[model samples]
Target: MSDLPLRSQLAVALGRTAAKMSRLAGKGDGSVIGGRIGLRLDPELLTRLAKDRKLVLVSATNGKTTTTRLITSAMTPLGEVATNAFGANMPTGHVSALASAPSAQYGVLECDEKYVPQVLRETGASLVALMNLSRDQMDRAAEIWQLAGKWRRALAESPGTHVIANCDDPLVTWGASTASGVIWVAAGQHWREDSWCCPECGGPLDRQEGEENSDWACRQCHFRRPTPQWALHGDHVVDPHGRQIPLGGIQLPGRANRSNAAIALAVVAQFGVPPEQALPLLAQVKSVAGRYTTVEHQGRTLRLLLSKNPAGWLEAFDVLQPAPGPVALAVNAQGPDGRDTSWLWDVDYRILRGRPVFVSGERRIDLAARLEAADVQFTVVDDFEQAVMSVPPGHLDVIANYTAFQDIRTRYGRVV
Candidate 1:
């Protein structure tokens, strides 16, 4: 901060002060507000703070927060890491995070899919990690292909920054393929609905059957999944050296987290940290922004999981407790959560057919109607806490969309 120009230094100071006040007032994490204030004072605050620091920008439709948390943890042993611990992904959050830890040696920033290009250009990040891309917050964000195009153009312009990208998602591959240096990771992609057509030629994408992690190719064009230098092979991550490193006992659940861990390890390896050393650090991250937090409320154990879109819900279902365990599904069409509930139809509610289910949120009726069509039995309890209480007094899994999940976090006194 001292090295920054007078205006940027003042902006940093004011931003930190505002963030402190926000925390004291119990308003919010202070990242967003502080960032807004800082940017208003100094438009170039992010670039000024990013000077001389090795930074990594992570962007994806799903797993951005978790992957950023994992990367921060893996990089912590090297030095103090400046990161937005909360799910603040825009430029404002980036400013707040860098301002809060001005002297940190490194930064790991989680960027929203739409803001990736802008943040990438602003921060001049040395490494950009691209995970899977899917349709999310359709009413608010750009189409997946448009975002991929932006990323491709951004990387083309910034030739010095290396890219770590998921090869499974064709859109991500197409975006990162233009980078001068790219470490492609065969991070698994569960959501294929959004990437059925090749972004390169608008051709039908063909998936090779029986192949390990089925390879995708364009039926009408030359675009195809690049052979990954780092690939997630079953329970282990195959590094660039072809050495299989086990993803040992990572506290975060599901294959999605395993993919995140693999991506994190790949990112840390760029800094010369061995996968053997980083995997243990990645395992230390139990919860990311309260995504996998479990708490006891009113004699009932509630395991909270956040599923914003169909892809996220698909992964959440994999980590859910065995069938017959009461499950609560909450959703909201709030501003933060794209005001369209049509994405609910993209999820397969039939999987919850045999299980006891409860729906709650501003859009509980929409969710209930979807469940009805899927043959899932559910009770609509408008109150989130009451919905939890209505379930049997035992262990229950609660899956919610963005705002609904935040509401649960607020009710439970902010699970971190």
Candidate 2:
């Protein structure tokens, strides 16, 4: 705890020791040492030192990592931006990011939804980006209403802060309604339209009729999904700068990425970067470590999609190509990735469309049972290597949960 300035050096030493111990004991997940070090450190010291630095905090049910990375890429041309790009979006992770960064002018962090309020209070972020909220980690995250209550209080306390919000989500729209100022980002019909029911009234949300792009309105009351101050229409971004940046050639797939790109553009737009300048920077960005990242293994290409909840899983399934070959799913019931495996039932597994799936992980049997109940045919393999090897030497798509994502990437000997 006393070793504040030497934290990075100590982390490196402890990481090496943990790696050696794991190798000796033939164990994985070298988290024991990291956990011990994390418990011993003082978060106050990290926060006090970071007060002079500019901070950008991004929080949501999904798209945090991808959006954080994209914002960081755009902000890099302006100044140094520190971030936790490895999915460690916790309090301790923020401390580690501060310890590891090289005197940055700005800090960009992807915060967990549950921890965002605490993080915002501790870090005093100048700019905060709140993406859509949805049902995620229900067993651990309590109810969606409870989470929304926390966010509402958090935003209310954070006055005069530049807020970037997604107006498409009902809960987020309500939370940001009282914000001092908000830059709203909306998507076309490509955005997930599954959870559009009004959070307050339980009435059906209305969408624009006959329009290719959809906008939401409450059928029962005046609570409506506010028109985005900045919108992404197809590849063009109508920016606050009055510049329409053409951003058609994004490498990442799905409509969700467009929403993420819009949020990233909004964040950078606050820093006085023109949309035209930032869109080109965002266009050249690649996927983050685990979210839809592709890697090569043994002469075959494997695309890895990290799906932690039903909404994220559904979005990934939307972008998945239904090929005649094989598709693999890795499920886990480990800590930090939720212990209850019932969320598998909530996922629209019917999207598999009779295609064969190879399932593996700690919760492999549970996932297999869910698939069977859904009348989906799947081959269950407890061994990770067996599952990967079972894929017929072609383009393989791997959809995995938080814990299983590390296993699949490690097995393929690829950095995600």
Candidate 3:
């Protein structure tokens, strides 16, 4: 803390005041803007806050926020964990989270995919969790392979960091493959469009018929899925010998979260928390930010799920279609959400064909067009709050991209 600049100290003070004012004005979470102003004032703020903490950095394309929450939940048995809640993966938000919990020893951070390497370089985090990689925000993100390449190089450079990586994803496997101390976890990856080939040799990965360890070996290069210390074998996350680790209170729905729990459980165990101890803590997390939170907006209640890309959309598809009521699929091409809505074209919206679909948001037209092409019937609800209410009553399912997700959540809490 002594190494911090005078300007940096003043910046954090001002940023906290602004955050309090933002909450008073009821602007929003105030995390993003407050951190933004603080970082603008003190560019080195994240480094300072990250110092002297046993940091666990979680980065992934799909499950960063929820997984970070899961990690935080599990690690509570260990001690105080400082994590950036809401959608605060950016540098500024990282700074703000640390500022809020100034004395917390365990910092569990959800680093944005693009910002992971920078955080690793600056923060000196001891444990780095690299989850699956997939296409997202094409306008802003590097090609998934490029991002994996960056991780590979970063891990190679930082040999002391213990890496927790998903072996199910070829990209993630390739990225942390060379890390000195890697605990591979079989976190499932359904989205494989971008991970079809070997990241090392660029050769087609061998998925031969009835082949053992095709999941284990790349026929072309040295790169292969390392033998995982932990894995999800069907329902239960198994042990080193393939024995089941009883997952009793996993509250988050679907296999995606189970996979997340498997990874999170493995991660905290490294931090000295046992898997059995981890589950009960992780299970208490019913919703993350607003991923699975039911928000009552304008007298209409909906369980909001954030779906940004095809992979994310796939995860929410199971949740949305199985619900008792109509499903609303909202989309937008805002800057926070990439302006390119072409990614929507790649999503399998055809699964919603039999269900009533309520499409809304800035680029609802683009989504509506995609749904139309998929033969899915949808009504374009221009007024978002009405769209939120328009869905059939009782246990409603509403899945939205980034901006639209935040819109309903903020409105539900009186923020407009």
Candidate 4:
């Protein structure tokens, strides 16, 4: 940072100062505001700070934060990794991350779906991982296919950047199909309503029914799920050598996390790190941004999980404990949460029919209506703590949307 151009050095220094002030003021961790000030001072700060760093960008609707954290952990053994570990996925956050660790040789950034192209252009990332695309924040963001088209154009222009893409998702497959170099991964997509049609052709996609690595092809075009170099089988990720790397001991729960681990391992392998070498590091990650964090509060074990959209909620359901264990859900229609609760209907709440369910939040009424329609019985409480107290003393799982999740985290002393 000292050797940077005078303007860049000033920008970094001011950014750090502003971030410190932000932390002092209890505004935030200073990631966003600090970077915003730096970029205001030097428009090229992100590009300048990103120079000489080996960067990888991870973007997706459901698992961006988790996957980014996983990749960061897997790469830590190689060198110091500068990353946006707090779920800040914008350009400003990118600047803050790069500026904070000027000496770090590696970076793993979690990018928002819409900002992937811009971040890729600015950072010139060596590897950009494309995971599944789905409907999220629909009121504020572009359609899934439109976002994919932007990614396709961006990847096409950057022929030198290698792409690690999920082939099971038609939108993600179409996005990376135009890239010069692509490493396809057979990461399972549990939600299919968003990609019922072929991204390349305006026709229905023919999806083959199978247990793992199911095939999907367009009826109107030749575009289809590419033969993946790495595939996620049950409890393992199949490497290029047909070796089954067991995803055991990963503290994060569910097959979605296993898929995240597969992608992270595939990413580290590009830097010559073997899966065996990275697996232990990946297993060390217990949670990302408090998504799967388990905390003991009020004599009850509460596992916190975040589910901002239908795809996220489906994955959250997959990680819940066995039936009859009390589960609490909360939702809020805030600016960050897109201010639209209609997407609640897309979630299948019938899966909670047998579980003891509790609903609470600013939008708990909306969630309750959906639960009522699903024929699931749930009790509405004032907030997360009240819901937790209503359940038994042993264990309870909590799933909440953006603002609601943060509220609970705040009550627990902010577990980030």
Number of the top-ranking candidate, with lDDT as the measure: 4
- Candidate 2 lDDT over residue span 54-148, tens digit each: 88889888889899988988887787788877666877667656655647778998888888788878877888898877767776775766677
| Candidate 3 ranges beyond 4 A from true positions | 1-7, 208-217, 297-300, 321-324, 385-392, 414-416
Which 10-residue span in candidate 3 carries the lowest summed lDDT?
Answer: 207-216
lDDT tens readout by residue for model 1, 318-413: 998989888998999989998999999999988897898989999999999999999999889969887777876789999999899988988875
Error of 2 at 230 (Å): 1.5
TM-score of each: 0.98, 0.86, 0.93, 0.98
RMSD of 1: 1.2
Q: Which digits, one per residue and each the tens of the lDDT, describe model 3 over residues 8-59?
A: 8887888888898898997866787888888888888888888889998899
| Model 1 pairs in collision | none
Model 2 scores a C-alpha lDDT of: 0.74
TM-score of 1: 0.98
RMSD value for candidate 4: 1.0
Query: Order the candidates by lDDT, highest first — what do you get?
Result: 4, 1, 3, 2
